[model samples]
Target chain A: MEKTVIDAHNISKIYNPETIPVYAVNNVHLHLLEGEFTALVGPSGSGKTTLLNLIGGLDKPNEGNIYINGTDITKLSAGKLIDFRLHNIGFVFQSFNLIPVLTAKENAEFIMLLQGIKKSEREKRLQQLFKEIGLEDKTDIRPSQLSGGQQQRVAVARALASRPHFILADEPTANLDSVSASNLLDLMEKLNREENMTFLFSTHDQRVIERARRVITLVDGRIASDSAAVPTSIPHEQVVT
Target chain B: MILLMAWRNIWRNKARSIVIMLSVAIGLFAGIGVLALYKGMMKSRIRAVIDSEAGHLQIHHPDFKKDNHPAFILPDANALLKKVQSFPAVKMAVPRTLAQGMLVTTTGSAGVQINGVVPALEYSASQLKRKIIAGEGFHEGKKNEIVIGKKLADKMKLKLGAKLVLTFTDTADNLVSSAFRVAGIYQSGNAPFDELNVYVSLTTLNEWLLTGNSFHQIAVILKNDDDLQVMQDQLKKTYPSLLVQSWKDLSPETELMVKTVDEYSYIIMIIILVALAFGILNTMLMSILERTKEIGMMVALGTAKAKVFLLVLMETVFLTIAGTPIGFLAAYIVIGYYQKHGLDLSGMGKDMMASFGFETTIYPSFPSEKLVMILAMVICTALLSCLLPALKALRLQPVEALRR
Candidate 1:
């Protein structure tokens, strides 16, 4: 049985449709299935992040319906959309935006707390996640005390802490050095393999694109190419879409 | 966790937060200090009225207070005085023979309230002997001795032993005159009272009026202030025909002054809190502006708008709570110290204060009950102050804010 986590149809986001209109994301259709390690790759102004924002429910599209796990997120109210995102979607930003004042563990537990998870359950999950992310010792350290790669790892842990249906990461490794970026990709790939977690990243890094089982290219808010149809690198665990 | 985050967030800009906290502390300190001072001054005035001028309770003939007419004297004032004196709470009870008269000297004449009092009992009621600045009080077994205020003595250009003639209508309505020599000059700090009042021997005044054993009023002083209203109610029940009144009833102006001071204290506190509120608003707004990206991240991470508002509100509360204890402790120490030692304003001019019937030295009294209201007002102010900044945080779009 295949579960389609995201099914966005004819989504078009215009910055200023009334005056001096700019189509940030124009007339695009995208679908992501459960347990798919996919990459959304494009040059600057090619609308990779914009499309990601639309699918992540961070921004509303001017036209078209976005269904996340059978719920039309585009029709949901602002407050409902936020709750939907909280339960079903995890976001990883380019800057690894962990709350500066909170320790890495606190940041990771933030989403679960918002979900009203009991302390015992949150602690159990946090212990497993921190150990899996290789940050068990760094859990008490604030983001400022951690390196770029460590902070990104913390962000990843925070995203997974809520057990969202899927993770949407935008340029997750842009700020990291080559070694840190490679290490982060390796950790993300490991999570994708072992935990069967779905990851959809918008990035310019070829390293990220190479590891992605299926790559989707966006050109000016339209899907230019999708490797989902053609079988790519991973012969085993084929994309179910 | 939101509370912890809010608490830690205030310390991000330590200097700014400290500045706002210090503003709150200093504002409350000054406000509490001024309130205590005003309370002290008013309390002193009220005590003076009750203890020195109008004893805690007074009983008079129904018509006596209407015009101080000598003919309208209390029918059995001595009996009433004895009864009042027997009460356990009664410290002293004295009979007064009041007459409206004119005092004439060679150089000038003035209208005066001639209070004919038994020196021994009057001294116990008013402590008037301590106020005498010149000569001794009425001599024992004195025939025709008078105690006039220093203001009256100065206005008439008269010294000790100077003769003055007092003329008033006697009981039969015939005008009668008597000559008296001034024995002592006293200054009671109240200029108006000093200028208008004179004291004389009760026996001598009765003889002059040809009204034997009759007095206009009986003044009662109590041992404890807490017994005032109860004693007054009891006395009122005992003397149904006569007019029995408490000091508040006798001196409505002092009572009004006390109420006015209370209203003014609240107004002063509100103004100070409002000023401190503005400081809090500005600081929290700046903090929100600086953390736009961070706040947007939290919002995007499914932190509800209500939670965001709470976080900002809690930050302001933390700042205010941090400052409040310092303010209260400082005020307590200063007010407690001065409550015993007194804060002297004599350097500002004793005459000015005395003219207004205020003591040169004031003892500050901080009512413990007021702290609860002050803290409630401070918390309300903090909430009001944080509203704008919190709304601003709520209005943020995660996509746009993260762009910043």
Candidate 2:
């Protein structure tokens, strides 16, 4: 049986709670298992990103307990949460936010450096990750020298280099061309299948949804539907290109 | 890696960074140059006070300095001179017979302080011979010869080789007058001293006063100024009845000038550095504000607040330190050149400088301690300048920062 990597019970996030009381994430319960490939889908203002932020420990929920690897992240102090994130989670943003002054290899090695990894081990992991991402020839170049597609690939390589328990990719393909988006999805799927690395994404792209094994839909700050099995709403043939 | 990032970040906006760096450089250059100039000027004035006007130490009959009375001459002038010259620290001691008198020329008359000195001893002790811009000093065996200052000679319409009458009261309370030939005209770069003083032979003045071998003052020059206080104290103890005073006590204005210059030099440097620090603070704040998104991303990617703060601090320090060497090197070159050739202030009018007893030509001197202090101040200002910007970076929340 797969272990539950993330478990949330009745988490709520309220904005202007003193007066207006608008709920960004309302009374949501969620659980993520290891090795699971999931996509969070929703319309605009449906609180998908807020839920992702809460679950990733980047934000705190107004009311609830969120456990990551059986440790309650919501109860942790801000500093401790940051340390926890460094050790247990990786993030991939849509804008491909690699440090501009650093080369690709240095960007990939940043998290490991923060974790106090030795240079040799960091180099070893960087070599393997660059090989997996097919950026071996491009590792010495800064992000400005690379195309948008290549930059996103380096971002993915950076996300996976630390061997975190899970990767949170927020709209990771939103800025890419169709060919680059398909290539990135293929790379992420391959990493999921081979390394059993759990993946979670908050995205509006139909391509991402079609590739995900499980899909959870949010509406009006609450989960409207969850498909634990392979998604069937989008036809497989239409997204296979 | 953080240091590398900091170094690269400063170059992100080359123009802005360069402006701040140049400001630091220029401020330091000005501060250091002004300090060196003031140091040189003060040193020259102090040297004049010690070597020309007053020797390192002076001994007088306690009542003589009170009124320049010829009756209050040293009781044992010859014995006191022999003993003072025997001290190891004393380079040479010369005796002078001082009198408040009047100098009358055919054209005009002026009040004067007459300094009656031995020809050879006074020449060596005060270097009054070097100050003679015209004519010659009193030669040996030249009787009734006097050396008047340029100002006094001009005022009384007197010239070298011209005869003048000096009138003063004798020790026996009788008015006495003597005629003396002016043999030399000198300028000591001290306007008031030049205008009010005239030197004649000690023996001639003593003969005219009918006082045998009596003198009012013994001026002592030391080989090393470090021995001044100790020698003064010894002389004071040995001759408890006489008045022994150092040059500083005799010339309070020169003492005040030295103290004021030392204090003002550091105050000026601090003002310049504080202005530079504010420039740095403004530039760093703008840089941090422009990089809001980048900082937010770093924080979101699990960078600790301390690391973020450090990055900002390192960037500011690098920028400031980059300019320090340039300022120091430029100051060194300019001051070195001026020290060799001198910086002439003749354009500001020589008479004005002479009035304050300073030479028109000044040589700038840079002490190593000033360099160390300026560098220390620069570093302190740099560190202080970075705090506000670093804290501003730390206050940024990752989510909101990313939204920008």
Candidate 3:
């Protein structure tokens, strides 16, 4: 009973506007099934993050279209696209973009604030999320007061605050240590199973890719391979298509 | 929540926010201080003229604005005085005869303009009784008595109860003479009002000026100074041919000068407001520039660009609200203290002010309208200067911002 939540066709993106263009994403096609834990991986300049940006409605593709949950985001008006991104696509970034002035709870409640959700409901939801994320004690503290890993955890909570259908993480673990990265992957894997949330990410770290049910590899702005991953990690063997 | 966030954000940048508030407060204090001082002082000077020297309105032989003539007179003083008394705002109406004359004694003779008034009625409408430095105001229902300026009394070698002779052109321009006991001497602070003016009984002046009980124009006092225009308009409507002069028109040059100076002050106020607006704009713009990355994140987090714009605008409006009340209080305090005392210009500018007919000490006074106008200027400039910051916040590209 798998449903396709995202479909990409012939999506090509160019960073350079010149005649001799640099392709950030080229001739890439992807479809993420409902309730799937998918990871995208490649080296630097390999277009993994570019592919995620195109799918997440943060950027436009130069030569193709992207559909999220069956609606073409490319056709949505700017305001409606923002609403779409707010409700259906959650994003976690490498830098953990928490507002320095706001507390962890406020950051977690940001999407609900944008949705015009009532404050009581937003607060209640934040309390539940804070409890689950092991950040109940840190909820009232500003991001500047928190460590890098704690800030990233707050970012993850905020991304999930709106109950989005898909969560996009770009190098979410790059700034974390080995233990922190493992803990974040476990949290994502649990959310992917219990809440039936779809997860897509771009990373070079094996800790993240190891938790994915499916992996998409990008090479030179093109998709090199798309395949399912073994549930258990083979510590001795490198993952290859 | 948005308002709360805006409030918290302002406190987070306390230094910048405080600087903006201080600028607005200073501007408002100066503007309001000037307004109060001008209004209070002007009222005092004008009231002095009305109660003591000039009645609220004047009626003169039409040609008197041109020159004095023994022949120029009102046809019937009793009848016109009755018509004037019918008006409710006329606190007390009186007939006065005026002529160019000379007061002579053994020691000296000096040129004078004699005002002949019914003394009892003049008492009810004037501060003359209080200003008398020697002797007393004209006796009630009596004759052969006169009051002269303090300076004039000295020149004529006259003392209280000293008999003085007055000579003037009679109805036919013939020189005639009369006599009076020196009654009182008064000073109105102006050398011109003090030195050359005289008051005598209306009956005696009628006999001296000689036009068979036909009197000069009737003067009036109104209950409220503000009612001058309304009363004048009503009086004009009631008697179209009767010439009426309100105090403003009676002192047209003084009125014109007050308005001119007020206009100049208003122009200066506008320039200060413009400068303050620019200062606010620069501060807000700098803050926006510093928060660019944060604003970009808000946009990338699926915040509507319109909301981004609104959030920035709300931050500015919130700051202004927080500051403006404090500014208003500061302005009120400064103006209130100065308005209670007065600005003493006596050291250097007193002589110049006296030459220009302003008092030695200038005090600030103004109506509520001026205060409201200044408040509006401060608030509008602060809020308006926030436009550039709001626009900058709105024009973000989510993808590029996320990348940054």
Candidate 4:
């Protein structure tokens, strides 16, 4: 049985008081299972990101409990929680968020480099991840030099380098064209199934939700639906693990 | 890796980087140059004082320095002179008979101190040799031949071979008089000495004082003038009864002038550092603002807060290291240029410098101490200015940073 990696209960994020207390996240409860591909689908201002941030320990909840890998991250200090995030969660953003000064491969290897891994071991892991992402030729190119698909691959590779149990990608495909977005979704889906690594994405794109093993729809800061998709003989569409 | 990244990040905007560095570099150059100039001025001033007045050390009767009176003459200055010559730094020691006197010539009358020296031995002990500017030097064993300073001779309307009557009281408290023929006119360019001091042979002074073979003070010249402090301290312990005074003690005003100029160097350097530190703060703060998301992501990726702070600090350190040397080189070129062709303070500026008793002609000199001090301050400021911005980076939340 795959252990549940993330569990949240009664979490609410309140931004301002005068504006009807915008409930970015309101009493939303959810679970992410090991190796599961869960997509939180919502319209703009629906709190998809707030819940993901709470789940990723990138934020704190005003009231409630969050458990990741059976540890209550809500109780951890800010510094300890940052370490926990580094060790457990990997993040991919819409902008790729690669350090501009670093080359493409260096950006991909950044997390493992932070984990104090030896250079040789980091290089070995980087080689495999780059080959898996199919950017073996663009290793030395900087983020500015790469196409959107290539940069996202590097970001995905960077996200996976720490060997975290799951990945949190916030609107990761928002910036890409349809073709590049489809290519990235295919890569992410492959990695998800091949490595049995759980993936949580807060995205509005129907294309993303359609490929998910489980799709969660959030409306007005509440989870409206959490359902598994019917399995089909869809050989390959996305690579994410 | 973070440091390496931070360093490379500096050149991402080369013009901006150079501008920030130029601010620090210019500050450093000004700070160091000002310090060197002040210290050099003080050094030259003190050297001029010692060279013209006391050489290095002067030995007087214990009561002579404590209370100024002719009665307190060194019992037998000849005996003390013999012992002082044995010390290492002492190049020569000669007895001098000093007395408050009045000089009268056909043209005018002036109050002065008649300083009597041993013609040959005093050559190594006083500024008499360098001050001689006109006519003929006193011939050896020429009795009654006097070398009067140019100003004193001008006041007395006396020329070489002109005779004058000088009156004074001897060590025994008895009135005495001497008539001497002026042998030469001298100008040491020091107002106090050139205007008031008159030089005469030791034989003439002994004959006038009726003391036969006694003197008041032993002027001791040392090989290295800086060793005066060490020699004075040692001599204090060696001969507690004898009073030895360095040039620093001879004229408190000149000593204070040298000290004040030296202190100005530190003050001006600190002010330069303060101004430069703010420029660095602006640059570092801007840099942190530009890389906010990057730093936040690095922290999210498990870079420790301490590492982030260190990374920023290390980058600044590298920048200062590279830029400060350029500043040093620039300062060195200016100093070297002035060192060769000293800055001219002639015309109008010369008169202004006279307020501090400095010559109208200004020279630039480089001291290693001032260079080291400026470099140290630049590095310290560069590092310190990184503190606030690094803390801001530490506070950046990973997710919000990306959203921004």
Candidate number achieving the greatest lDDT relative to the actual structure: 1
Candidate 4 lDDT, B250-354, residue by residue in tens: 878888886777777778877887787777778778888988888877776667788888888877776666678888888888988887787665675653464
Pairing residues by index, what is the TM-score of model 3? 0.84
In Å, candidate 2's interface RMSD is 1.0
Alpha-carbon runs more than 4 Å astray in model 4: A17-19, A229-241, B104-110, B150-164, B180-182, B351-355
What shift in Å separates residue A122 of candidate 1 from its native position after superposition? 0.8
- Candidate 2 Cα misplacement greater than 4 A, ranges: A229-241, B61-90, B104-111, B167-176, B208-211, B226-244
Sorted into a CAPRI-style docking class, model 3 comes out as medium
**Model 3 lDDT on a 0 to 1 scale:** 0.78
Q: Give interface RMSD for all predictions.
A: 0.6, 1.0, 1.5, 1.4
Q: Per-residue lDDT of B1-404 in model 1, one digit per residue for the tens?
A: 99999999999999999999899889989989988999899888888887678889899888878876788888777777788899999988888888889999999899998888899888778877887898898999987899999888989997999999999888888898899999998887777778888999999999988779878888889999899999999988888898999999998988998898899999999999999999999999999999999998888889888899999999999999899999988998999999999999999998788888888899998867688999999999999999999999999999889889
Candidate lDDT scores, in order, read: 0.89, 0.88, 0.78, 0.79
The DockQ score of candidate 2 comes to 0.54
The RMSD of every model to the true structure, in order and in angstroms, is: 3.1, 5.1, 5.7, 4.4
Estimate the overall C-alpha local distance difference test score of candidate 2.
0.88
Better of 1 and 2 by DockQ: 1
Candidate 3 residue lDDT tens string, A1-241:
4666777777899867577798999877777777888889988989888888888888888887777767888888888888899888888998888887789998888778888889888888898888777889999999999988888889989999988888999899999998888878888888888888898989889878887888888899987887854322221112221
Most accurate candidate by TM-score: 1
Q: Lowest summed lDDT over 10 consecutive residues: which window, candidate 3 chain B?
A: B350-359
Docking quality (DockQ) for each candidate? 0.77, 0.54, 0.50, 0.60
TM-scores for chain A over all candidates? 0.94, 0.93, 0.91, 0.91
Give the residue spans of candidate 3 off by over 4 A.
Answer: A228-241, B60-70, B82-88, B100-114, B118-205, B212-214, B254-265
